[model samples]
Target chain A: MAEAVIEAKGLVKKYGELEAVRGIDLQVAPGEIFGFLGPNGAGKSTTISMLCTLLSPTAGTARVAGIDVVHDPARVRQKIGLVFQDPSLDDQLTGRENLEFHAFIYSVPAEVRRARIDQMLELLQLTDRASSQVRTYSGGMKRRLEIARGMLHEPQILFLDEPTLGLDPQTRRNIWTHLNDLRSRTGITIFMTTHYMDEAEYCDRIAIIDRGQIVALGTPDQLKAMVGGDVVTMTSTQLDAAAEEIEKSFRVTPTRVDGTLRMEVPDGKKFVPRLVRELTVPVDTISLRRPSLDDVFLKLTGRAIRDEEAGDRDRMRQMASRWMGRRR
Target chain B: MSVETATKPMAADLTIPVDTRAASLRAIYIIWYRDILRYWRDRWRLVASLAQPLLFLIVFGSGLSSSLGSGTLFGARGGLSYIQFMYPGIIGMSILFTAIFGAMSIVWDREFGFLKEVLVAPIDRWAVAVGKALGGTTQAMIQGLILLVLAPFVGVKLSVLTVLAIIPLAAVLAFGLASFGVMLASMMKSLQGFQVVMNFLMMPMFFLSGALFPLTGLPGWMTVLTRLDPASYGIDPLRRVVLSDSGLSSAVVDRLGLTINGHVLPIPLEVGVMLAFGVVLLGIAVVMFQRRD
Candidate 1:
């Protein structure tokens, strides 16, 4: 297992009375694309920050690249690269200048500094725009520049917080291609956090965190398999009547989420036809598909991935913690 | 997609043979250099910073100098124009304002998240603090030099040697205020919060530093304050350099200078106070930064 590039046990971070990360234990093998998937304020970033040495855990220890984070954080910083959740580029500087500044600060060797930056710039497809100020960059380009800066130091592990966050889907896919290419070429371990459920498919393994604890952890297929079958979804104007009639006839209750009745059937394709012939109420729409990570999140967490009301409450809590001088 | 992984044992790249001391020094220089690049990039900011000092030197200095009617305030020298006396004050004010506001970059970084990137760097926190102080000092010193260009127009002249001495002295003053600003800004979270705190601390420090008036013959409490103010020591040295060319007797220069128990404070001594205060304040700032995580 390549000595576990990152290992955490019972890691917890607290802000006064509120705990951002309760007790987490995980590890990633060398060259693994491990994802921490959780909604906002679900302790994804706090756990990442602890591993990156930006924040110390209240209880427990994490070791990155064989160095204990708490005991010798500076050495850990030397071995890891981080892309902040927020855009951290000095947008005022040209892309090449930004990379050079990072190279110097990270103490990249003078002889090879220019070459390493040039290589990263090319790897990210930012070579032609290298002399342009980051402010002139498109969102995806800026993110790519950040990724290049993160890798210029040639660290063993790279931690990206929400790598595709706030990017258009097309751009997000573009970043994914770049990341996969980076891993195949250098075999650098990638530890990233993202709330996008579909995005978890790109990871080799994922840990689903919620309310400061890991609810589930596994590869995407393994976690989806936990839901047991294909998912069937139906939306109707009269949800109450449709839910009653379907349960009465089929004896299989469908869960209600966002005004849609969802049921997991052994054979969703066959079941959808029977339901169409037998259901009493008129349905607006009905669909059958394989279980997604969102269904997995729903099954484990009892709420959909894009749980807006809960998200707002979590956002308020995060803001309060930040006001108290803690970063989530 | 299959990774086909070796994790490519980055052995050649990993062992760069680090000299931690050299790395720390380079980190400091890069951080300082980054600030210099940003300063020049914002042309409006560069021009805007000097505007207030110019307004004070031309409009406020002219207005006050005429109202006081030249040397009426300085009974001893009898030839010191209000503009000449206030010239160094305006320079101190410029440095003070620029240094304090320049520290806002630290707060901006915090609010915008760039600070976290720098904080997580392998370098020591004190290096970052020192780099920031140097950056702020350089910006303030540049503005102070621009204010110096206004001296000739105000009818005050500087010998080549006076300008030479004033250069480092001006930097020292800027360094002191910059350190003080870094100390204040390190503990603050938002730019608005920093602005409020700076205004509260900055206005009093500038006004009470005896920059606008002579420190001698002040009321007891104000005299105590001006003595305690670091800018008082900083500006008094610049005044001593400028007034040195006035060919005033040492008695008049001493009267114009800051006095404790009727002994005029010497340039080396005043400079020593400013230096010590800046270093201590900078130490506090570094400690604040270290504890921030």
Candidate 2:
């Protein structure tokens, strides 16, 4: 469609000896909602930081709104709105004051600033509480306020790093609805990062990053289709014998994972019954299910996406490096 | 939620194109204005910060006045007393502590996560630093003004003209000192680290400044260090202005005056030094902010 709003070529970020984002390449078209899906420490935030002009890439180049992030970061900053993973709102300021601060810095003209702010507050359903200090708002309200602030400047692309990370499930869904609504109304481009497999379903396209590289990138349905038909999993005490028996009998390899034998077939319903009847080994239990985003992640990354503790540790290491960098 | 609450048409209008220069100026003003507004909202912080200047002016000034024999004659009767001699020092101290600590607001902002809001703005980083410095300067100057009420009790004279003269110098000193604080705070990222810096760095700065005593007759090394301390330059001009109107003897003024190469630093020169100090430190702070936080 339109020329990419955000384009990067082999972008990399290094903190001393550690490479947070090894080498990332991405492109987001105008009006597209793109999501970077990864477990914690997967370089989602790092890549977003480079695109937002908050960090310098160590080994590559990136362009946002056609302005080079490194060559002219100040201009790049003007064209993009960012809602960082961390809580970045000024709690001391009212919700309205917070939006006003963003508007002023982005140089929203005085003539239209008040109207735009009122519109944003009303859009976020914060008009009634706009005058109260931000610290008094609940966590969900704060996230919504941040989203309102991000859209206040009318940037070409909005970057949100883990926008719903710490929110309750209901709040998460509400934010998703608002994002979709904003996209429909303005056709604004959204580039966000999330670990939630379900949330990735909302994006037009998803990039699955593991370690420091994109393991897979496609629409949610397309990625899930890669897993094909249906999945059949069975647990038995003689798992190895059963796996061998099923493979030989059906001519389909069964992979043993977490003490269970899993195999994919065109139709689990047709395959499971025949396998159960034909199998020579006794099975304790068997189940059939459709493939999900989590299963796709598992198949691509070779592990589950529940390593939140790794995420915490990775963040700590990055913060420490940042602090040490400040010293130099 | 009502149907009206559904998302309305948005992102359709003209988003303002930043006039870089004008935006920079606005950035400075809004950031400074925010600091002032926040301080106004927190009354306890304002009242609590007043304690340091008062304790120094009354307790420290009075106790030392008794030990130094009311600062006359090396006790000359009816001459300027020790409390009077250190009055400017107390005001300078007030500005020093308040302005410097005020700059530390950035670190608190960092910890609380609000600093990212400022750091990521499209405007110049210098604007942010300058705005923060101005905010801290205004607050420091106000604290110095608050101590002016205690001047009469300490036996220091104040006319409208005397106060008028003190205001600009104090503001300059506060801006310079606040810039210094902003510079330090920008390099640091933690409040606990700032507490350590306050003790080790701020204590020597106040002590070395002639706010408490004259610089004459100190060890050679100590004299050089005091001369280098930016706080001394700030305290000197204010000292000159306060003792200038007091009719204090030439001897007392000479003892309390800041000197370079044995010549007393003129008021204009002291103000120039302070201005230079503010500019350089704030420049460094701008460069620091330019680096990714």
Candidate 3:
């Protein structure tokens, strides 16, 4: 078995009364791409921050590159590179200057710094824009530059916290391509947190997080297998009462997705006969499809990830209001 | 996904050995050098620093000198030209302001995540603090010197020898102020909070330091306040050097106590005191920063 490059045991973080990260345990092996899948406010960023030594855990321990993050954070930082959700590059600096600045901060040798800067520029396809200031670069270009800066030190482990969070779909795919190339060429372990289901599919292993805890951990196929079969989604005018009746007769769990009722059965086509006969209300439309990451998320959390996201937004608003009241 | 293997070389071929300690020092130098380069590129910032002190000299020196009529308005010190008396005070004020503002950049750095990058690096946190303090002090000194060059143009005359002698004193003062600013920066969490403190605390400290006028002119209560001010200690020696024909006095007998001769020894006692202040402030800043993580 490969050695673990990053590990966290019962990591917890709290902000006053609110527990941001309730106890999460994770392990990423060397040369592996481990994706942390969660909706907003699911403690994904908090966990990553603790592991990277940017924030100390309230209770628990983490180790990165064999160094105890809490005991010796500086040592862990030396061996790990972090790409924050926000582009942290200085806006006033040119692309080349930014890499040079990062090289200095990481302490690469003078002789190696120049050559590495050249290699990074070429690798990120930023050679033409190297002389231009970062403020002028597009979003995709800025993200690419941030990635280049993170790798300048050649750390053993790289932590990307939603690296492509706000980028266009085309730019996100480009970032994924580069990420794959980087892992293959350098053989470095990658620990990334992403909300996008398709992005999670690219990882060798994924941990689905909800409400500050990991609900499931496995490969995509393994996670899908847990649901038992294909998912059948039916939209009805009376979904509230009909969903309960369908569940009773079908002997399968049915979750409400927006205004639709969804259920997973061994064979959706064959099960449709029983579902229609058992339903007390008329169905407006019916659709059958294979199980998806969204279905797995809903099955594990008992609510769709979208609903959890909205719940978090409301919680954040309440927290903000309390803080402002205290200030006044 | 295609697991396309590279035909070039294995991991063994790319392995290169390095000394960890040496690498960390190199990283610190990079952070320091970049700060210096940024200062150099911002010509307007440099101009503004020089202009502030000159404005004081041109506006305050001329207006106050004419009103005070070149006599000993304070009644405690010897009769001297107002322009000569206020030159050193302005220089001290310039040094103090520049140092404090220079350290204020830490707030910007923190907000932008630049400070976090340095804090998480392999090197000691003290090294980062030291680098920042050194950079801020150096910038303050350069700005102070530029004002010193414009002194004669603003009607404050001084011999080249006197100017040379005062540069070292200005540098010492700059280092002390910069260290204090770093200590404050580490304590304050946000840019807005720090700015408010700077305006409320730092501005009053400068004005009450007797930077623009002698302590004797103020009311009795204000005079006592000035004695307790650290900026007073800084400006007193500098004023002595600029106004007196004997260069600067080593001692002065006053009602409060005997002001020891700052110029008597090989290195002035004031310089030693300022150095001690810098060391203490720097120690506090480093301890605070390390404890924060």
Q: In model 1, which regions exceed 4 Å deviation?
A: A16-19, A235-251, A277-284, A307-322, A326-328, B1-17, B70-77, B246-249
* Best candidate (score: DockQ): 1
How does model 1 score by TM-score?
Answer: 0.91
Tens digit per residue, CA lDDT, model 3, B191-259: 658767778878888887767776654566786776656666666656665553433343331211213
Scored by lDDT, model 1 comes in at 0.86
**What is the TM-score (0 to 1) of candidate 3?**
0.85
| Model 3 DockQ, alpha carbons vs. true complex | 0.33
Candidate 1 C-alpha lDDT tens digits along A152-239: 9888899999888778899999999999999999999999998888889999999999999999999999999998689999999989
Interface RMSD of each: 2.3, 2.3, 5.3
TM-score of chain A of 2: 0.93
Off by over 4 Å in 3: A10-23, A56-61, A240-253, A269-282, A307-328, B1-28, B70-80, B158-160, B216-224, B240-267
**Residue A207 C-alpha lDDT in model 1:** 97
Weakest 10 consecutive residues of candidate 2 chain A by summed lDDT: A319-328
- lDDT per residue for candidate 3 within A109-211, as digits (tens), equals 7789899999988888999999998889999999889888888888999899988876788999999999898899888888999988878888989999998
Q: List the residue pairs that clash in candidate 1.
A: none
User: For candidate 2, what is the DockQ-based docking class?
Assistant: medium
